[model samples]
Target chain A: MFNFNFSGEFVAFFVFAVMIISGAVLMVSFAKVVHMVVSLAAVFIGVAGMFVLLEAEFLAFVQVLIYAGAVSILMIFGIMMTKHQEADAEQAKPLHETLTAIGALALFGILFYAIRQSDFPEPEQALAQGTDNTMEIGKLLFTQYVIPFELVSVLLTVAFIGAIVLAKKEAE
Target chain B: MLSSYLTMAAILFCIGLYGALVKRNAVIILLSIELMLNAVNLNLVAFSKYGVVPSLTGQMFTLFSIAVAAAEAAVGIAILIALFRARGTVNADEYDEMRR
Candidate 1:
């Protein structure tokens, strides 16, 4: 389980792993709401870096754009619009918090055990590593997955409109 | 390699789950949900690259999920704002309209 190669990919993955873990930990521990959002942005960027390392360059950029850039900004706006404490008053829900932590850790333990136990067979055929991942993705989006693509776009439109409607001021 | 990525994703998912369940702020809870979604995306992308049937399907799935996650975030924030407007507080523990 401890074996590792000194490949470039290995090193990159290691760095991103550290970055993401720390950022996520900080997000959970930070008392300030804005600080949590900032740390979450770091986690988002680290995930994008992992995408790049996995050769999904287009996905990497999209991750950066949507999660790190747009979503982070949106969350910050949400915080700004609401009345937030400078330091979130730590509620005395130790039992609830402890139970939740145990549940989450149990889930992780199960997942880790399953991952370690399973032996994934090598692919008989190598995936087509297209020179231009974006172009290839575009082709696939326009062809094989066109219907779902269109549906997702429609979902986005409806969701944004719904958000506007739900948040609009009531003129009583 | 695949195991490593999967393990990393698991850790993220667990952390997100904990945060979502424990965080008091509704916005932070929403952010934690996003974190959970992101962990799933990482797993999908990792499998796309290293799974037995290496294909673009997983990446395509990731793209769709990302779009959905964006939609979720927008709608979630809007609802949160509405809730805050009605109640004048952002604490998750205080949203007990249904309970009462």
Candidate 2:
């Protein structure tokens, strides 16, 4: 019989799992866009915590920096900029919204069923084998993945330019 | 422990999908996409720690996925801004110009 010891790892995992699921629920159910964005930030931070538990420290940092920092802020800005006239006008809508909600619930049910049925590989060993993945990742990225790395840089630059152009106001 | 983490990830992914599909607001859609991306990242890190593969391919793929997600967000938000400017609304239903 397996003893149910409350190890530190188990505690951390439980906390992180609770954080992620609650954040997800908040993100989906919240009516306000800004609240949803905040919930998403929480979810991202929880995912980062999971990365730390998985021994991917660098990925955790990147997750916090990119997803929680940049992406959530950008989403909030988008929401602020967009004018929701319909949302202002109709405080309650029975027909279209009810249909959309039903569809979404059905889709969620299907996805949940698929996820529950999938077989995942069990971790026999206590921990991952080999050296720290951070070092290995750096070496591989610089050596074999150099081209893709450089391409991503170029892509970011292009996206920056494109965003600036797209957001530029026309002169009257 | 693994089962708990996996369940969390699955729930996150499902919520994200529902939000993306049901929400009419573009910003909410974007948030949902971010949620989905994080779900995938969680799975990647989990498998990297637990899977049979000795190498850190899961982490590498996650890095690439993040890069792609960043690029997608930039373009997606820019398009959202443009759509807002053109149509004066960010509802996806209003974007029925392509239906014809």
Candidate 3:
């Protein structure tokens, strides 16, 4: 049974849940491209708050810095490069849209059923957090996850270079 | 508590899926994909603190995924711009050259 405790965490969780869901729904409903991105930014910020509620302070800041800041600006730049037209300009595909909606709904129903039926064992312990989480993460990144971290760096470099190459205009 | 987080992620994932599949704008499709990725990150972070074995590994995974997502968004925007320049349009439906 789900007990609704009037704790601060619960209140915060509900607030973020409402923020995220409404923002996502607005993003879906918005016709204008910029409005959609703005709403998605709200959703990203809400997710960052959720990260804070979960006590992943570093990830919360990372989420804010990356998703809310970098990604939103990147998306706006993308919108700038592309034609700004109404979303459903070309003849409406009601059948296609309805099918997609039904499929997504079906997937959600399955996931919800699975989540509700599973009996998860109670957590044996909370994550051992040091006073400085960012430092802790930095240590883990250098020590435990060094190889992957390095590889990701390489990936980022390659991806950005490729992106620049791809986006650059051709010589006429 | 865990179930509630899972449910929230599932809802966002579904909405993102709907948008990705239905949207005509390629940029919006990419944004939807990011939305879905965020939902997954939320799940990972949620499980990190609340799972049967709590650890920082989940958070580590989130960090890696977030980095990858940033790179993905960059490349995606680049491709969208290139496609727009090549075809003079950003509509996903219009980019069906293979079907022709």
Best by TM-score: 1
Decreasing lDDT order of the candidates: 1, 3, 2
| Native-to-model Cα distance after best TM-score fit, residue B21 in candidate 3, in Å | 0.5
Fraction of true inter-chain Cα contacts (below 8 Å) kept per model? 0.88, 0.56, 0.86
lDDT of 1 at A21: 100
Candidate 1 Cα lDDT to native: 0.94
Model 3 residue A128 distance off true place after TM-score fit, in angstroms: 1.4
TM-score of each: 0.98, 0.85, 0.97
Tell me the tens digit of each residue's lDDT in model 3 across B67-96: 999999999999999889889998898899
Task: List, residue by residue over A1-172, the lDDT tens digit for candidate 2.
Answer: 1234699987898798888888888877776677778988988998899898888888999999999999888887887888864332334456766776687567657756665676655656645434666777888899989998899899989988998788777567
TM-score of 1: 0.98
**Segments in model 2 whose C-alpha atoms lie over 4 Å from true places:** A1-5, A85-133
**Which tens-of-lDDT digit does each residue in A44-66 have in candidate 1?**
99999999988899999999999
Docking class of 1: high
Q: Model 1: how far is A126 from its true place, Å? A: 2.5
Provide DockQ values for all models, in the order shown: 0.85, 0.55, 0.85
Interface RMSD of 2: 3.3
Q: Give the TM-score comparing model 3 with the true structure, all chains together.
A: 0.97
